[model samples]
Target: MTTEKETLNYGPVLFHYDLFPEKIERHGKVKKVITKRGTFALKEAEMSEDERNWFTHVIQRLSEIGFHQVVPLYPTKFGDYTVQLGPKTYYLMPWFASDERNERAKDEVLLDHLGKVHALTLKEQDFSNEVVEHSYQYLMNRWENRQFEMERFTEEAEQKTYMSPFELTYLSHFHQIMRMTEEAKRRLRDWYDTCQREKRYRSVLCHGKVSRNHLIFNPSGEGHLLNFEKAVLDTPVRDLAVYFRRAAHQRDWSIEEGKALLDLYEKHVPLLNEERGLLISYLSYPEPVFNAVDLYCSKRTQYSQIELVHRLESRIRAMKKIRDFCDAIMIAPPPSMDENAPKNIHIHDEEDHI
Candidate 1:
């Protein structure tokens, strides 16, 4: 550990206050500065003035809404959220102690805050039907291309004189990949139809990178979200999809465990019907297949054939778990407008989407 006697200085920004650097810790691009005032994390990234302003606004908004889960950025004495020293730009934020690993209570708090963030940030807008249709068509076309690639690979493998171990393993699971793709397409079509009929969709400022690493829990077991650089204006399910996928993967794709996590989130903010359908669509996609295929075909072959086979096998197991989860939590289709008055669609526990 290195300590600085004088305050840290960068370009026009200088810590003139009683800020003695007690210790310094570096993780990737982020530098944690432990000082007498408080522990602060620093990151050097290329950020424009507008981007800096946007980040400041987001943090301020979250703080104003009483959502303190986000690690707040401390402006310099000059009241600037970011400082530039020559060509390099730096941002500062208070650091909270994070548990080395995720605990159940920590995750619960994380989802609770996330749901509140989504609920508060949600804005209703009448999405253009054409735009929605086009997006769905594009997704379906991409899925079709992936299926075609899988078929091409299978045929190539069949024609080979001696199939490699990876090829044999992949070939064995080809049907499963195809089935997953088909299911994804079907769910996507349903989502598109629902969106088209609804005409409107809800969008929220999502914490795009919802990973365990980004979740920081204090000593008291309160969780705070860090790294909003990838945050975007998207459907609230975007965050849920990321969180649930990682959670499910960590828990061996346990359907009950995933549902329990979802239950925690819904306790704070219940998901709408279209939102649930979209979540299914997002989870149904054969991301593992696409990822494995991309890696296998890429010029960089870092892993051995055996390693690739193991990776694929792991993915197959994960995919199976996700499929089981989807089946268990499948929301019943909406009633036809002509059949009868629309009945409320409720998830398990009989809780209605607010």
Candidate 2:
């Protein structure tokens, strides 16, 4: 049953769509709004005016290009795709119930859909030295800084006569972690060099946050994608790296499964050589492990030493799996390029609103 307080709180936002919620169930960042009209997913996000506009544009543009698998935004009575109430923004879509039967094959479906999106929007660019150099140097410097910080943390832990369990765990694997970091840097540099030599690069409309959770099956068993708030124009590898990295952290995820998924994606849009290298570079970095250390440093008192150690250990294990995954794909060649691969994708000027 819907609480009176909940209905009152959400009523103003729903007013724009003539939706008076009978029940509002919290589901992560979304609200399951049950109303007389029908069930809907009310997505709450903190987006600026510019972001809201771009997000709508991304959805509209995808549809314009014949991609309609996205969960569509329900416009208000006033024709606005989003309703803003104070600091929060709300968008509406028909809520699809979770289907456990389709859960197992979600990854395959996600990858296949991702590849289709990438293939459709892929744009080859004539590289600008300024862009390439700035990107390369910026990432390298940021990574190097993070590497230095982790090293300093290790030094501090080593100097302590009696280190905490988390610190000791981190220290033991510190050298192996550093090796991965270096390997990541080497691959990144190689990607940059290849780009400079080739004077080329590719960009696609990346989903930014690619996950099984962002997908849901409709009543007819067709998968539809949602939550494209973080979409951006970047290398196709950006989405792949994010998806693969998170997937690797799962206990059931295997290298063969990842490879098969990658193969499925490649069938639609085969990666260029440097793009593959860049993907490897992105995956090889042990950022998740570093994040664990940050959490330990900032909130150590909030969690037990054993808890922190287990957290760090979990990330380290994931990194080891990622290492093996990278090795398996290091020499795997990109599939042959598609003759009908998207070309002539017209990207507007940034001033014109990307």
Candidate 3:
């Protein structure tokens, strides 16, 4: 396998042959390596000095909790939670191999695994107050700041418009989603704040990005949640929404499937009804949030520009698909037969809407 490290030239920290001859796969933020000492993955995340210190504490807390499905690897050679290489810091973990992919597995199965992982680690983990505060503030800051920047991208100016007709159309739709995302962020902030006011959100270590890519399903009927770079002290259900988003990618899973996964997770950790709303909010925008950020930074005018634009367009197309899928689910709430409750929960696609 061709390792991306060899090709990516990010200044002086170039990983050389001396780093060892190993092949690894890039999954989300982590790069997995197969070696003589068994497979391991390196998680690279950018953080401020203070956040790095907090991250170290969070990692230590995770180690104390004896997290199952997710394992934290100590850097015995470096004597630190992570090695700072220029603009980035990297953590490591044991890479696990799994059997054939469970392509047909329902979304509930994914939720089941996520719930187990969340239940195992978040329960009783002594997350420091700093970490908890930082995670929330960071998330809110990111959501807010990104929303502001995305506004410019959505500006309907002739000069700012795309050159081609197809590009212009895609840009228009992309801007609309960006608008919806901003609104979603506002709602998320409101809900998150309410959780804080009610003391419903306990300070616990949460897998920030819980998706199919970060998971490895083993032949022994086990799914491992890898990549803890985003792991921090936050509401545990945040992980659930992220995982659900990935499951929602393929098809509109029946409300039964969603409930089944909820039950599976509840088995490991009990979730209050309010928590479910937060999870749904997190899932509202889905992948577009990430895609928007990536495209914002990826834009350029040169040799590699066309390729990046193509990728951005592709992601926008994906965003549309996800938006429609989520719309169908919202139009038909779970247990649609229940007459006492409202027939459908209106979900709008607008920037900063989450």
Best by lDDT: 2
* Per-residue accuracy of model 2 over 161-277 as CA lDDT, tens digit each: 999889989999999999999999999999999998989998888999999999999988889899999999899999999999999989999999999899888887778888888
Which pairs of residues have clashing backbones in candidate 1?
none
lDDT of each: 0.71, 0.90, 0.55
Off by over 4 Å in 2: 336-354
Q: In model 1, where do residues sit more than 4 Å from their true spots?
A: 3-22, 45-50, 84-89, 100-102, 251-253, 331-354
When 1 and 2 are scored with lDDT, the better candidate is 2
Q: List the candidates' TM-scores in order.
A: 0.82, 0.95, 0.58
- Candidate 1: worst-modelled 10 consecutive residues by lDDT: 345-354
Residues 1-354, candidate 3, lDDT per residue (tens digit)? 754554343212213212443566677776665655666666678987787777676556544544455555555353666667778876666666655566456345556655544554443323355654676688778766766655554454335533544345446666566655754565566666665656545433567877666667654756665556667655676776666555544445444565556555665565544455455456655345456345545554432655665655665655555455445444443432223322222212222011
Candidate 3 lDDT score relative to the true structure:
0.55
The predictions' CA RMSDs to the true structure, in order, are 6.6, 2.6, 9.7
Instruction: Please give the distance, in angstroms, between residue 21's alpha carbon in candidate 2 and its true position after superposition.
Output: 1.0
Steric clashes per prediction: 0, 0, 19
